[model samples]
Target chain A: MNRLVLQAQILELTAIRYTPAGLPALDLVLKHESQVDEAGAHRKVALEIKAVAIGDVVRRVQALGLAGCSVFTGFLSAQKQGRGTVFHITGLES
Target chain B: MNRLVLQAQILELTAIRYTPAGLPALDLVLKHESQVDEAGAHRKVALEIKAVAIGDVVRRVQALGLAGCSVFTGFLSAQKQGRGTVFHITGLES
Candidate 1:
């Protein structure tokens, strides 16, 4: 199974604008400590994920009749060691 | 001279409980990448700092009559790139 991961803090879970095409969005305030972006920058950046991935994970969970609300607290991270980037997914928040 | 640095996101600057002793507290939601604490493990953790150091930074600013509200966005970091945690302070948020 393919998976994607992001490294950031769960700043706030406040609601975002309900887009004209999809459900409401979420505003995530995140930071970076040592990793550099495509711009070769060394700093923290805040990005927003308007639409949560409703792919494999979402589909599988929905099939099991499990609520997606629980995934809201999962912190994502993209870690780069000597070579290669690994997607690290944290365990579901209790 | 003494200095302290923290690495985390600005999460929410909402007003915190006004202790009968001080002004207000700022809640920070931060994360870690590869560094390990005293326990000797690899994982991420979130910590909070209340009652910001109103020391040299605050004292020096108060001398020039500059408002301290500006420093609210400064992100602190305790990075262990190779060894020895170095105190890194971000430039004032412009």
Candidate 2:
């Protein structure tokens, strides 16, 4: 079971592109900030992560635009040919 | 509203250390592999992520050792001095 639920703002977006299989895809960066309790102490946490939305989720994300924050449900995967991770978005709650 | 739940194997581990505030900390890498449904297709997902366990969680992780997999509950954070992300582990289920 691998899942990540994040409430984040769309920080940056790229133009829609088509995969080799002809599926619609969008790439974006997500900024997340929240106060969390860890080790019995409250701490401020923030981050910006690269994410990708494919197929149906891409249209919803485009409609939502980048004006507000949304909750994204997804899983993490290593880049196809890189040393970092990317969030593969499957669902969105705006 | 940021949370990540992943079942992963401990791929690498560093020696336990202490923060300036004297809190115990441990750094490690986790490898996750699963088959997920995405955009109407069954996809294989795998990733190796850098993670940290602090305070009470550190001891528990050490006790669990690296022989088996565990479910980790955590949040993602930007690296303190880098361009990548790190998983800040808050809880572990063996």
Candidate 3:
């Protein structure tokens, strides 16, 4: 099980691209800021993550503006062979 | 809301440290491998994330051997100085 639920602002959006299989892909950067409970204390948290959306979700989010705040549900995977992690957006709720 | 639920192996563990406020802290690396459904397709996902645990959770995880799999619940935050993200572990379920 690998799931991430984040409400973040759309910081930047890259132009849509296509995979070798011709699937539409979109990449964006997300900025998240929130207060979270941890170990019986509330902490202020902030993060910036690079995210990618594929196929229909790509078009859906592209049609919608990449502005303001939205909740993204996805799984995290490596960006390439064995390095950094990238959030793969599968669902978006504005 | 910033929540991440991941079932991953404890790949590496660092010595327990203390925060500025004297809170017990532990840092670890987690490797996750799983199949997730996205865009109507099943995709294999794998990620290696750096995580930190504080207070009692640090002691609890420190007491247990970090040799097997465990489910972690946490929120993502910048590692330091607004740079890369780090998982802040708050709970563990083995």
Best by DockQ: 2
Q: Which candidate do you rate higher for TM-score, 1 or 3?
A: 3
Q: Tell me how candidate 1 scores on lDDT.
A: 0.29
Residue pairs with colliding backbones in model 1 are A6-A76, A6-A77, A7-A76, A7-A77, B6-B76, B6-B77, B7-B76
Predictions in order: chain A TM-score: 0.28, 0.94, 0.91
Q: How well is each residue in A1-94 modelled by candidate 1, as lDDT tens digits?
A: 1112333344333334443444333333323233422112354433322212222233332322312323322322322323112222222232
For model 2 the TM-score comes to 0.95
Per-residue lDDT over B1-94 for candidate 3, one digit per residue giving the tens place of the 0 to 100 score:
8999999888888888998878899989999999998777788988888989998899777765576578898889987854667989898876
Instruction: Give the candidates in order of TM-score, highest first.
Output: 2, 3, 1
- Tens-place lDDT per residue, model 2, B9-61, is 99988889998768899999999999998889998998999999989899888
Q: Lowest lDDT 10-mer window, candidate 3 chain A? A: A60-69
Q: Which CAPRI tier for candidate 1?
A: incorrect
* Ranking of candidates on lDDT, top first: 2, 3, 1
The DockQ values of the predictions, listed in order, are 0.02, 0.86, 0.80
What TM-score number comes out for model 1? 0.20
Task: Give the per-residue lDDT digits (tens) of candidate 1, residues B1-94.
Answer: 0122333333323334443445333322332233422112244533322223222233332332312223322322323233112222223332
Each prediction's whole-model lDDT (CA): 0.29, 0.90, 0.86
